[model samples]
Target: MKTYTCQCGTPLFFGNRQCVECGLDAGWCDVCSETAAVSPEGTCVSCGTSVVPCANRTTYDVCNCFVDASLAEPGTLCRSCGMTTMVPDTSLPANVRRWALLEAAKRRLLYDFRTVGYPDDQLTALPPLAFRFLSDTPDKHVVTGHANGVITINTSEADPVHRESTRQQFGEPHRTLIGHMRHETGHFFWMREIEGRRDAEATRLFGDADANPYAETMKQYYEQGPPEDWNEQFISTYAASHPWEDFAETYAFYLDMRAVLDTLRWNAPEQVQDLGDDLPSMLATYCSAGIVLNEINRTMGLTDLVPEVVPPAVVSKLQFVHDVFESLRTGVVSQS
Candidate 1:
């Protein structure tokens, strides 16, 4: 999440469609992890060619990466982008707008995965990752749930009011579209992290993977309340419901730290001008940055953006997860 500057020197964001200062098209090149000047012939560094459309500018309704076009037929969709197991039916009058927003969010999520040096190719290869955006039916599909390997997002998420209501209903102070993306991607990563590695130690730390994740294990607990000591053992109350939820919450917590760290670097480039990949040092830098960030938020009379503090034990766990991600990139652990 390092900052990007347009050719005109204006800052750019990963999802920016245009450079406000220069009137030029802006796009994220997965290979370089930076916003690049995109022309018709522009290509992503990861893919080495323009295989997809500019993710930033999707008016043509195609991938921005341009990697798919080079790997497949002229009009072929990128294998990664084509991994949409399901999309909301745009023909439905009410869904047309929501579906577009979801697509934009999905592309951003995929881009983040790539920016962090994980391959979408490997993720797609696993049971062929797919997504479904559906209209919620009280007796039918749940608003948000993961089954098998597919992720189902509720179309209602597009409505700000509905999302806010759900946040209040759940007693969550911070919830947003991107937060939803981080949480759901955690589920996808759980499959990668736990598959075939379920030893006693791993099981003890995470849980017995054999348990049914969807069953009402926490039915009684919800009726009563989360364990009185939830903060001691669980990442969040939602995580206390199931082992699978715990993993997802932990994974999301890792993503949150990485994102916040990136934001810190972006806000104070001079401070981290020559940073390295050492996790502990980076975390220390973020610790300092967090203090300043929270103080600034307080000055504005805003609540802390990141309220949860990662305890020492959790910090160690997060470092391990980051190592796992690094290993995956180096072929030490094949994401496949």
Candidate 2:
């Protein structure tokens, strides 16, 4: 979430398609790993490199990311937009808006992935990561989940009223477009980084992902509901459904903590300046910041900004995630 310098020295943000101060076109440069002013003629103003604007930006006014022009082929998308193999039918105006929201959240997720030093395309063995947005029709209902690296999101989840209603229906403390993106992405990463390679350790922390059939576990979970002490052991009631969910939920929370800590680093440097000893430093910073954020939300009569409690067990699971990403970042573990 760190702001970048526009070509005109204005502050550039992730979603900027045009610099507000200078009126120059702006987009994220994949090579520079920053959002900056770029000409519509396919030139990065900041880096002096040729880059192609994402087609979605021009056609639908949805994207603000660019692809390196030298590497881009006909119809090539930017890093984030490229992963999307399907988008909801854009003929409907509502579907277009949903796609916009999903793309915005996705950019944040991809930014976090890059910030954590994940390799862009290193997992050759696993199915390629992709996103598919689908809208529910009369005969078919699209479920939001992940399989074989494909993350499907129901367009209805992007509607504010629908999302809030569903949140209350599920008894979730917090839910939103980014939350859904982060959560389903958790499933994809588990398949990519942990499935067979680190299952033993992951199981030790979050239980066995293969202990029971996922369908059966999910069916039983909705039928019986989470345990009374679910909050003590898991981040959310839904997380208590199964171990894969446990891992995905924990991973999603880990992403949330990292993203928040990044903002904290900018606003209150003293609070999250150093990620000393990794997870412990992060936890300490998060606990300190969450207390203030939660109180501020309470004062405003808003939902708690950081509602999920970081219990001892949850911290252990988060520690495993930190280690996994750290290993990726430092090349301490072989991705291949």
Error of 2 at 301 (Å): 2.9
Q: Give the alpha carbon lDDT tens digit for every residue of 39-125 in model 1.
A: 545544333556455332354343444333444445444333465566666567667677657666777666567546776566767
Looking at model 1, report the run of 10 residues with the lowest lDDT sum.
54-63
Q: Return the TM-score for each candidate structure.
A: 0.81, 0.94
TM-score of 1: 0.81
Evaluate residue 233 in candidate 1 and report its C-alpha lDDT on the 0 to 100 scale: 66
Point to the candidate with the largest TM-score.
Answer: 2
- Where does model 1 exceed 4 Å of error? 29-34, 40-80, 92-94, 137-139, 209-214, 271-279, 333-336
Candidate 2, 292: how far from true, in Å? Answer: 1.4
